[model samples]
Target: MIQNGFMTLWKSSIAFFSLLLLGNLTGFAQQSIDVDSLEQVYLQGNFAPADSLELLDLLSVTFQDPQKVIYYSETLIQVAQRQDSTQRLFQGYLQKGNGYARLGNQVDALNNYFEAANYSDESGSDSALGSVYVTIADTYSMNKNNDNARDYYHQGIALLRETDDSLSLSTGLSNAGDFYYGLGQLDSALIYFEEAGPIFEALEFRIGIGYYLGSLGMVYGAQDKPEQALEKLNECLEILEAEGDYYGVAAFLPFISDIYEKQGKYRLAVQYSERSLDIATTYGLKEQIRDANLQLSELYEQLGDPGKSLKYFRQYATYKDSLSNIGLVQQMARLRTNFEVNQKQSEVNLLEKEAEISELRQKRQDAALYVALGIVILAFMLAYGLFRRYKYIQRTRDVIEKEKARSDDLLKNILPEETADELKEYGRVQAKKFESVSVMFADFVGFTHYSEKMSPEDLVKTVDYYFSCFDQAAENHGVEKIKTMGDCYMCAAGLPFPEKDHAIQMVRLACDIIDIVSGDGYSEVTGFEIRIGIHSGPVVAGVVGTKKFAYDIWGDTVNIASRMESGSQAGRINISESTYLLIKDHFECEFRGMVQVKNKGMMKMYFVKRTLQGAEEVLLNKTTETGE
Candidate 1:
């Protein structure tokens, strides 16, 4: 085992060493070709010139190598078309558009960004649309078209509500704020800057927060509050210092110098202005350095140094015009040429391709006709076979419907309508303990004697008649029949759904039973008077079984209720004190105090007096307690 383990370890070590060697060799091969080109541009702070041009040249060269560009663009489009996600499609268009934009193709970039917006709209991806909107807005801003830039900025803000991307929203807000500041709308600029500030703070976007604060400070400076402006601008510097954001520090310093210039502190302004120029030059920010030089020129003039002011002013103008020629206007002209060329070529190619493709399809159509005919015949045979299967399924469905109806009827008989609904929805009913549910147990007095006297047929007939009367009485009183055991009838109120007037319902059910039995329908047959016992207390009721299910009540309340029924006189609804308390006010009930009957130490009872006036009084009897 030790030898085998050693051998395995040696093999693993050899494999790892071989993989490392291969990776190192590949890395070296890549390093040998143009590695320093991108690296030097990034490391030497040459992003404004070389890095931008390199990216543009790379995209232009790769476009003719269609295999290279097509992998990214075509794959993105294919996935976007196949999937239902519009956001993903939007991202694909955004990336493709960015590729075109990098090659100085603004027209294609604009078209693709609009396409992204459409996809994002369909997908409800407001955040993704916000990104595309920001890009379009920034392009317009860079071209100095402030009106179009501000319009797109508001549209992006509207889209930002649907997305929780604080970083992106803050960036867009900061840009819009700066644009407003440049247009001299100081108050509107402050509002945008402040709005963006909190979002950056919440997201912990340190760089974005610093920029918004600096922009806000610039707005305050314009509004003539140098002290307030200085506070915000200094805080901006503190954040940049802490974050070591040299790029941000370069951008913000010139604005801080303006705040000093506004406070009549020309010396301090000149000092800060020189520092801003140093940082901007260090970071290769030529545009920011030009702004700093202009500030310094004004500061020198304020300090009574016209000679130095003129020198710096000349430097500022030279840098400004250089930036305009090489940076903004030149890029715009390149974009215009690319746009016109692509637009004309694409339209011409599309029209030519459509006309040329309409001819070779006629010969192929003649051959496909025979194949289509054969396929139609095969489809008919398959459809007829499916029809026979459908008929057999219909017969099975009829049997299922009948069984379902039978089950529904069984459930309705066993449970209350509401209780049945709850059981179906939740799959089971929770057992509840009712402290004052009225239970009524009725029995045919001398039922055993009557059974002995009558023939079997006559006894069954009499019992059936008695049961039917009991069921009707229970139904009329809104009580549930528990079940009939031999000659005794059991019913309950205040469950399975509880009611405040359960005792009343029970009393009515008991009285109805009595009235029904003594009526002319059964008076000629010589039936025995019924005895009823009512009790109120806590009882646990629940459905218990895996296969054969039934709802049952348990505990001492049930037992005491049965005892009350056994001890009661014929034609009386005898109830306990608990039941009496609930229903006594509603009915003419006579108290039967302290009855000594069963295991219960002692219990108060009541006699329910039958009201003769009207159905209203009898209905009130349903509320009376029969004390036992």
Candidate 2:
């Protein structure tokens, strides 16, 4: 897979080489020419030098034939030389360079670009000079001389800043982005591409958007973000397809295919690769054809179709050989050797100029150096102070975060998790009514009497020990422990977060609490018993209070549950009629005759002994197990 991915990248790079030249043809649609009329005027030998120059520029770009471009450019150069028109000469040389570059003749292309630079320098046309510098940088980039490429790119941008040429500036930024992208400097590439995106959009340049977004998509894909890549690439593909730019569409298809393949969408990968192949074949795009074949070959292999994989691999090999015969590597090598030679000569010239300046400024150099040293020392002191301040602030932030976490944990301990979250987010919580919930109340049988006999600390510790045990039991059975009164414990099931098995869970929790208090060790240590009552009905639960927040429930259900607990005897579990209906099939119960309550009228109650074995055995064993 790694080898296949590298091959795909190489093919994409080759395909994009042609696109690099098309930047200059942005307004070609507006430059349409009547070839026959232009040729007739050129043959008549009566046109002005400016008219001749315009004709040649249009012919060079519009023909789509490299030999014709070369012919028109050479003829234009001859006419400009005869007429001593430096601007026309610069244009002719630049156009010739473009033609040679398109034909994969980088040696001649660089020579013509340098010739154009000489004429542009002599004429002092900053715009023309910037354009020549951009072409030279692109050629160096193609040759992989990154240092030279970057140097010339900066020089071109510096010159372009003095001219009002937004289109050229946009193209230069995009080209610089592509150079960095090819070198795998994705962050730097993204900076340039994003800078160009707004310029292209303002100009309503669809072609520029297509290329800019495509570069962004490829960069995102290299970063292993397939979704973002698809978003950019799909937008680019839509624009290219609408404009009937089939070659541009073909160039982007392989990138989409690679993203889909990485996402494990094999069918979409194959579909895109095949579409790329069809478009490339129709348009005779050799680089795209080779890329599509390679992608399809690997995709088929992943899909476990060896026969189709082999077929596409064979086609890929044939096109790969054809691409090699185009002499791209040889051209790049020659271009690199020439660039190195020119760069060394230019460095020598710069050193000579620097020596002359050094001799002229020797007297002032010492005073300037002393002033620079003092400023540097002062700046360093300020920077050090800022750095220390930053460290102190970071430490303070860390301490604040730690304390915040501790407080949040404390708050969660006092309230239910969901209620605590809501209170923190909204500053208050609205009460919500639950149609049905299980409310359980547990009270120590002789808590008040035992407290009066023992020391205050001893009494508080003993109560804490038993309530802690109850807390654990409630948590284990998924019951919410609401709050505890002085001698009574209060809790419920199914508020804050709803649970369908609230009644069942509450029953289990009550049983666990009974077992904990009646244990041999527990009874001997504290000499206390617990009474638990559970009743199921509608209740409204919420956090109440602006300062000291408390989560509590209210309704007739709470009243009945309290009555059930108060009416119960020692060491036994009592439940109201509402809760017994919910868990009748699960536990054995004894129906206590109707009991009168203060607020609530007569209510049916039951004493829960132990869980039943089965529903049929409820009738067979009507006996209730008495507490120890």
Best by lDDT, which number? 2
The C-alpha TM-scores of every prediction are 0.44, 0.47
lDDT (CA) per prediction: 0.67, 0.78
**Residue 144, candidate 2: C-alpha displacement in angstroms:** 1.7
Candidate 2: stretches off by over 4 Å: 2-23, 26-50, 326-628
Separately for all candidates shown, the number of backbone clashes (residues 3 or more apart, or on different chains) is 7, 0
- Per-residue error for 433 in candidate 2, Å, reads 99
Which portions of model 1 miss their true places by more than 4 Å? 1-70, 73-85, 90-370, 416-431, 452-469, 472-476, 522-528, 618-628
Q: Which candidate has the highest TM-score of all?
A: 2
Range of the 10 consecutive residues with the lowest summed lDDT in candidate 1: 14-23
Query: Per-residue lDDT of 229-278 in model 1, one digit per residue for the tens?
Result: 88888898888667655545666666566666656666776787799788
